[model samples]
Target: MVQPVSTLNHPTLLESPQEWDLSTLYQGFDDPQLTGDLEQLQQTAIQFRDTFRDNIKDLTAEQIADCLKQLEAIAQQSGILYAFPALIFSADTRNTEAKQMQDKVLEALTSIENQLLFFDLELKNLDDARYAELEQSAVLQSYRHYFYNLSKFRPYKLSEAVEQTRNQDSLTGRQAFINLRSVHLGEQEYEPVSTPDGKSCSTEAELGALLFHPNAEVRYNAYGSVRSVMQQHNSLYGYILNSVAQDHKLENQMRGYDSTLHKQLLADEVSEPVFRAIMSGTRDRFDLWQRYYTLKGQALGQTIRTCDVYAPWDSQPVEPLPYKAGVETLLAAIADFDVNYARRAEEFFLKNWVDAKVRPGKRGGAFCWYIHGKHSCLLLSYTEDYNSLFTLAHEMGHGLHFAWISDRQSYFNSNPPMILAEIASTFNELLLLDYLLKQAGDNPALKKTLITRQLEDQLNLLFRQSTISRLELAMHDRATQGTFDHTFVNDQWMSLYHELCGDAVEVLPDHQYDWARIGHIYFKPYYCYQYTASNIVSLACYQKYLQVGKDFIPGYLELLSAGGSMDQVTALKQYVDVDLEDPATISAALKYVEGLLDQLQATL
Candidate 1:
């Protein structure tokens, strides 16, 4: 459902280069500096291991702080070394040199990590009393959360030798399967479909854009073509998926995790009870999802099929918003909210940190990759529509979040957990929504489009993502027991799809192959639920901002600046007065969705 809106035909916009400049990291794969950095990173790792391999338990608080600072420097070096080739590979998956460099970097980094694994392992092995004393010392005050988070994994720590073995094996074990999925998808050729503009799509991203086309036949054919490719290769994708799941299953057991979900929640710094609450809360509100789609069906004067979910509400062709116009509008929205945020966001454009050009061999979807102690880079294929505009705002929100973290926190504390990662991005989207709605003014058609778009986003984020999470749980359960084939996954996906859609939307046959297309399931397990949880939290935070007005900016900024220095639950409660543990918090967000549905219904 996340696709570009329309193709930009403006000469001025088209003339501007939309690629990101990576000279800030390195000039090229063959750059001499890239090799120098790798050599230095390996040396640093050796020095770190030789200095602190078995001495962590005996070190004083000040000595521990010094050790951490050294590790932080090493991490920054390794980040640059890995990020360079990885970014190049992302820009063009088919680039053989880039892919080779990526693999080489990964092998080297894995060895480096293996050398440095003893520091955390020994730290986690420290006695509880001594650990508490060092954690509370003034010398280690800045790293108190770092120590606390490390200790949470104490029960999951394996022997240093075993840990090192796993790190080395992942090159050909778990990580290899993940890479296979990426390369396979990148090489896939979807059958081209006809569009109203006589446009044809060769890549999955281009085909995805057609799903939002005004013509129903175009949407249907695009959907069918995408699934047909997945169906043709379902066996390979299924094997990759099973391999990843089996790896997770074995590792979970080895780490003493009660369930695969437990291990994922631990990494997110979220409690199992809180995760269950979010899932239950989302599942309880299936009616809202059904009601919205039912109304969409009425508006279209036809039963909403699976492919019609993203169909345009208006049959008239939409004027493409030029890329420059989209940028200006996004900046204006941030400026209207706060001038400081707008100023920081402008740097992404000014510094050439964004790659928005659409081209073959480039990966599908958008992501913002942040290098600690440096800036973030965004990648997206821009087609000059409202969806692309919102995607721009979302990824920039991530860039701004990382900007604050890089400015305020150490590298050790800069990476926020996945659960909190989506907060700023989703918050930015809501702000843009409000700005565009107000700008619509007396234009009822524009207002309806904006409103319906927001509703669709909420549906995708809340209901659809939660359903994916459910499928993940089921998949992991089967993996824990024995094994499951593509057919098992297909049936489970359809079952969950039917549960979510109920009698409102028609569940198509091609929808069964849809599970193969979700890259996250094969890449990061349990990542989908974070989208659901973050959406709920973002809605609550946005509502609070409306109530508090200007008073809310400082605490919100502080939340972003805090990064991983504090647990997300405490950060949310302290900064925005939103409690994730409370059922009422979930109810409030669902109420807001209902209010939006009511507004759209009134328009109908």
Candidate 2:
């Protein structure tokens, strides 16, 4: 039997320390300059396309450089084009104007993209030796990385009309399905979960916190409420997931991709064997996950249910950390290794570069949106819990990466590859954790809690994602063959959980529709494993930091500043001294996890 929750009220949530000032991007939806910028992009794109469409191959290298400059000018302003409406919708999804503007932006950009499509297509068609000469010229040297990477897709190139068809249909294809999923989720309002205190929560963020509630009964109730809500919409979500996967399947066949994951690997610029190396290392360490979960079960004095996996293994929950305190803590932690990181982090908060408010109709999770090619703005729905604070730091980490790389790399190489995108964010999280642990000093209970956090994050990032990658691979392969359904997803997902997480936790029935809720897989197929890859890579970076201290700072920062100047594997091997292809690197990272388990076991 569960202990009765107290029949009394508790503090709900603290006010957000600050709301983001989006003026850094633009003043608002109606800013006159917003219209001016969009018109400017249209004028620029048209002029460039008309000037270069028939003569890209015949143009001098200097002329090509001028064309690129005009193109980048249009590209830079696109931040306001998409980011403005996205910010509006994220804050208030019910706003019809915002929704209309989002549609408007997509349509407008599609036209501009359609106009610019010939540039790359025509360039790729240039005689191989001629293209080489162009790529090596002084004017094109900075864009060398861009042209070289673009060439890899030449084998998969289609006619300009076909490419335009693909681009146009995309608005109605997988992207539309993803939008439907987001709307479906955002529309849901879970029925309130009754508490022993007679209080209740129905919001996604609030109920999510209850999953880690100090009281097991509260956690169970919250979990039941969530599962019940998800069950009502399971078929809708299932349809969404199925349709999205099938979209990728059709495209995969069209493109002759090796498999669904092969395209992602190509985009990520990593090889299949290297990708499998991550999976293999995590697969070999099932014992470690089992041990950790078993210990957590022991701590809970009962079988660990899926709901209890993230439950705190402590005497009681820690007090919610304030937003201001969270910001200060993260800044101080980062200051030790790189004072500049702290400065960038401060700029995010100080310059109105973050949206930290939490309210109805706002998106559920945190994200860092890179504005233009210059800097990133963060969107966060901050709760008082430390985990939420970690979310803040995580997004800020992405902001710092964008800020650091902005001045160093041209727009062509400005964005980091998806595989390395999470590294800086995860790195920030590790440093924040370490700083918090040190701040705990001689408090054994606090240390245990910190260790528990470390384990949970590692298990999810390093292990669970690898397992999810298997499910994604299976789903895409099956979707290609046909007749895959919700039941099929449940079976495939459960098999992965059992194999990766073991029987240390019970898999409840409602958890079967898990695939329905994942936005990443739906948005970008075979995209889930980067979390696993990045976690292992970040852990290895942290290990080096411990061994070399501040001396390691320059190399790590350089890696971030390098952006997409080099592929992920080369960057890691050169800067962090770890190779994705090296199984030992994964094992070495696992050692840090093992040390945490050892410390937690000692406390027990």
Candidate 3:
């Protein structure tokens, strides 16, 4: 067995890059506690169903309060059980033990989740008067968002048999195609970097990093290798995409949802108009993306390709920052915002809450995962670039949000939705960017570099993400209309490219397969819009922070603490001034991106 990444000795957790300590989650897959917890969870679920499934609608307010407690207890246990193995597997997919443990967890979870499915459906079926009566009780006030959101599906509830069958098919159905895509993309290695000791082929993320490489030849070779590999498998990837898209379409149709995007908006607790407004607002700012790309090409003193868009301006060799230095940088910046936010962030490192090392088999990209009513875990592959530091801040931002709010809210409402979740992470990124800019001071050279990168983040977080969402909308719409195959998918994907970048940058032929490259469409359709939504709102939040300084911290903290206890739009209205429903909110966000572009241009 691959030994667990050795736990750290120094408090820094970075003298050597630390892997997360999962002992708190479980001792091992074979730890009898794994089985014991599963059994206990299963028992609780069965007991819950047996006691409440038939009588949920009739439970008095006090009884309903108790019912929620039992359900929350059951859910909290199951959440931990599901998260551990799933996380372990991502760290090392090659581990047979990890794989088998994850499968076991999935099997147990499916069974438990199946048993508990009756709770929500039956709860939703309660008469309006009953649900209102339960919600109005002072005892139930804390859970108001939980039950109200639960009852949201009253209009769309399917028969128990249909829902159960759908859950059963989930593993083998669209999920299988998603898994296939994951394995296929993860396994393919690209040509090595020109640096000494570089291997003959690189991991997918290593290839992605090359897009930022200063050596133009190395970047182009890596870019070509990526393109060639993607093209080689593009057809099969296309097949997988079509299969999953078809599966999603079939599910949406069966459920009577208005559209595919509509389904996701509902889950995010956002309305369709809000989603489209963010999307359209971003679309109207494609010129900002074009300006950034054109300016980047000028800085590079060469024609810009899709690959070169992320290339940093200065060609000087950037010495990799020590991981500890990166942490200090982020912590100091966060401290400038709010001491508690910084303190909460420091705990991730001091307590060994992060797995920030890069190794073969660990997942690509960075993510923050929640541990029910406890703290959180952050996983990332840290390089020494400013981008790496930004990623560190980005995830710790999430860790801090989850870490703090775990105490503020109950199990039922503690887990925030995507709409609000992105705000914390993206907001932290803004904090980091602001910190970097201030540190640059009057040094134009440093200022130019940091500003360019900051703008690049906006392009990435705001514009590129929304473009992907637009492509998703078209692809899903076509799927609903009739036949959709790989070719039609490719054409639509490329069409969005032409529209998004115009004549500013080359789209290249193989970029058509980008839809397949995105795992989100497979896992959570139309989810990309949230990044745009969150980034724009985050810009608004940052602007407010600038205006009110420390006064803004309380509201921002309140925003995070509210978690998923309220629908996202309502949460924003209650805590912050931004409104997702207003096109003007998005318009203001675009102006922020435009301002960044203008700064970059002024530097040029």
lDDT of 2 at 508: 77
Model 2 lDDT, residue 479, Cα: 84
Clash totals in order: 0, 0, 0
Give lDDT tens digits, candidate 3, residues 478-589: 8888757778878888888888888788887767766666778777888888888888888888888888888888888889999888877888877877777778778888
Cα lDDT, model 2, residue 250: 77
Off by over 4 Å in 2: 1-15, 194-199
Write down the worst ten-residue block by lDDT for model 1.
1-10
Candidate 2 local lDDT, 199-289, one digit each (tens): 6788777777788777888888788776776778887777888988887777777877777777778788878887888878788888888
lDDT of each: 0.87, 0.79, 0.78
Candidate 1, residue 279: Cα displacement in angstroms equals 1.0
Query: TM-score for all predictions?
Result: 0.97, 0.95, 0.94
Q: Return the candidate ranking by TM-score, descending.
A: 1, 2, 3
Cα distance off (Å), candidate 2, residue 365: 1.8
Q: Between prediction 1 and prediction 3, which has the larger lDDT?
A: 1
The candidates, ranked best first by lDDT, are 1, 2, 3
lDDT of 1: 0.87
C-alpha RMSD for every candidate = 3.1, 5.0, 4.0
Off by over 4 Å in 1: 1-17
**Better by TM-score, candidate 3 or 1:** 1
